[model samples]
Target: MNDLEDLPEKNKIFESDIFIKILTSPREAFKFINDYNYEKHLYILLFLAGMLRSFDRASTKNMGDNYSIWAIILISIIFGGLFGWITYYIYSALISWSGSWLNGKGNTESILRILAYALFPSILSLIILIPQIAIYGETMFKSENDFYSSGLVESVIYYGFFIIELILGIWSFVLCVIGISEVQKLSIGKSILNLLLPAILLIFFILILVLLFKLIN
Candidate 1:
């Protein structure tokens, strides 16, 4: 289906098939979303992603003794929202920077759209929370023995959700590649490089910092 043809009107961006298509087929979905107007969806998408992250973090905490449930919720919202927004800009900037080096012509708007929507998969990571809460109860994650100590089968099932969560995280990266490649007009190879170059540079810079620290000491 040509998702663009069935796109929601300006007043109802969330109601659009273009929104759903962002998950199933990001490449085509991004092309259409980029072609049309969907700026309002960006903040909403990022906020939802933040909430999911907050929920995941909350599930891992022990809300029994000193930690309040309300406090965890508030912290999650504030920290998750702050981190999520910062990450949005960082990714958008990184992709834009990489695009510039690759002879790709795109602006922050397109990069932001791709990166924000790419978060759809990570939002799906919240599904793992149900199993996590079931296993850990409302106690500290470090106190696993006090709750349900690990057995072979229990361990498999418990860790299995985390493995699924990790897979969803990777799936998000895959979607990012497709969305960024299409929006930035980059080939697949260049798109992969565009995504990886940031992490590579970050590691290189960290090593330099460590070497400098050692020399100073």
Candidate 2:
């Protein structure tokens, strides 16, 4: 009887409320998530986020007339899932290592967990793609198709959905900053700096490599 009573307590670690809490009170949500190690659907979340990102990238380029919509989606799912997992580990490691310079307390696992949950907004943003695909089909991925010239109503719907997607993407970053701050025990400003540190170093390293290549040539 006591064991049965305790089951819910133990299983409550997997509660879905964290999804709602993450959006409403991110700091507390991240702290609880990190403390409890709530890692349910972590891979799925990352994979879907990666798919959305991949699809966005594909939409920008010309996919050509040879590819079908289903084929593109399949490729995005497979490649994007792989890319997401790889990038998640790399970014988490980079952030964890860089945070140490600022005396941060978070390790890679904790940062990874926080980042996974932080992507909730982006996962939700996937809904916007459905109607977009339904309306535009393969033309959505083709650069030659000018959507704006279609019609005012279609253009309005397209831009409206785009705006919502943009907001969600921005909010995902905001949640990321908040989660990092909670895990790293840094202020919001410092958290932003910690997040940017990797990109900054990568850019600097690329510039130096470019200079070296030019000199060698």
Candidate 3:
């Protein structure tokens, strides 16, 4: 009972003290994550990601009015949770399997949790949406053409957000590499290999399937 009551405070400490380190000092962050296995906030992170995803999708398609804010959030959480679970499991599984061949060391469960931590950068990326909503306003939610057809200042804001997203995406990938490497007991190079191997295999597999289909035709 006491521990449950204390979980929120403890989580606050973890978020403040540890989560920020993920960007500045990822090796230490991964060490802490591996040692403590802080898993409580994963869902919260996923929920935030969901909200961002929902908002982005709505804005991109200009379907903002199609769903109420609460409805959009709720729907996003459901779909995001489903997709997050599947992607996390698949990515973790690949890391566990191929990562081992690269001399990486980590279990599926731990990798999954670590991968959730990697999403912190993505959450930060959501900051872009604020100005996006302000600058584009109803146009973002009403019509795709209107969203893209921006004035000079609006064009600058749009491209600025795009650049921020790109940087954030790269930051997230780097954090994932560092976190995965630390947990898996792999060197950075090998850790990257661990991460990329599955992707390469998938691409190769798709190419083979395409070739076979063409032959069959």
Candidate 4:
């Protein structure tokens, strides 16, 4: 509600629940929007979606339609691609109190963003997964499923995906900082630091991974 600097040290722009963080302070977040850079927040939403998709894919292989669990990967891909941009309108609609939009509410910009993110990633995922499915044909992702399903190897790969999603979120936050700071004429160094937060996190997680591998094997 106040200047960015005035927020508490623990206001925590990056968060575990991206939706909650963004949606929690919808008015404050919307104020970040400007005429020239409307799309900036879209990236933040996308990054959030990516993080969710990453975690859901890696951590929640056990839940929901596991019988056709391959669909989970496909759906996650769609969420990752589209939610980033799609969320901006969703945010705006909620802000405007457009209660009717939910019943077949579709804006061109929102639709375009959704189609772009969802379709591309979904297509790419299907491409990659088709081969994996054809090779391992009938098998599906399970928590104890080994390398194809789950294992040390799978853990590493999942970590890799989690890192990638985290990186995307950090990158989006940096862009937000840069745009907001520059227009508001704040320090560039501060923006850089926001981006650097992810690097520190990556190093910490990588260390965990190493220790985990050592323990398991």
For this target, which candidate reaches the highest TM-score against the unseen true structure?
2
lDDT of 2 by residue, 92-154 (tens): 999999999998899998899899889899888788888888888889888688777878898
Rank by TM-score, descending?
Answer: 2, 3, 1, 4
Per-model TM-score versus the true fold: 0.76, 0.90, 0.76, 0.32
lDDT of 3 by residue, 118-176 (tens): 87887787677666656655555665444366688777777878888888878888988
Candidate 2 regions exceeding 4 Å error are 1-14, 64-66
Off by over 4 Å in 3: 1-16, 50-75, 137-149
Model 4, position 11: C-alpha lDDT score: 47
Best by lDDT: 2
The C-alpha stretches of model 1 lying farther than 4 A from their native spots are 1-15, 52-70, 138-140, 143-149
- Candidate 4 has its poorest 10 consecutive residues by lDDT at 95-104
- Residue 125, candidate 1: Cα error in Å is 1.7
lDDT of each: 0.72, 0.84, 0.74, 0.43
Q: Write the per-residue lDDT of candidate 1 for residues 82-198, one digit (tens) a residue.
A: 676766677678778867899876677778877778887887776666566556645533324442566778778767877888888898889888887887788888988988888
Tens digit of lDDT per residue, candidate 4, span 46-73?
5545535543454455533354545555
TM-score result, candidate 4: 0.32
List ranges where model 4 is wrong by over 4 Å.
Answer: 1-67, 73-86, 92-154, 180-217
Backbone clashes in model 2, listed as residue pairs: none
Q: Scored by Cα lDDT, where does model 4 land?
A: 0.43
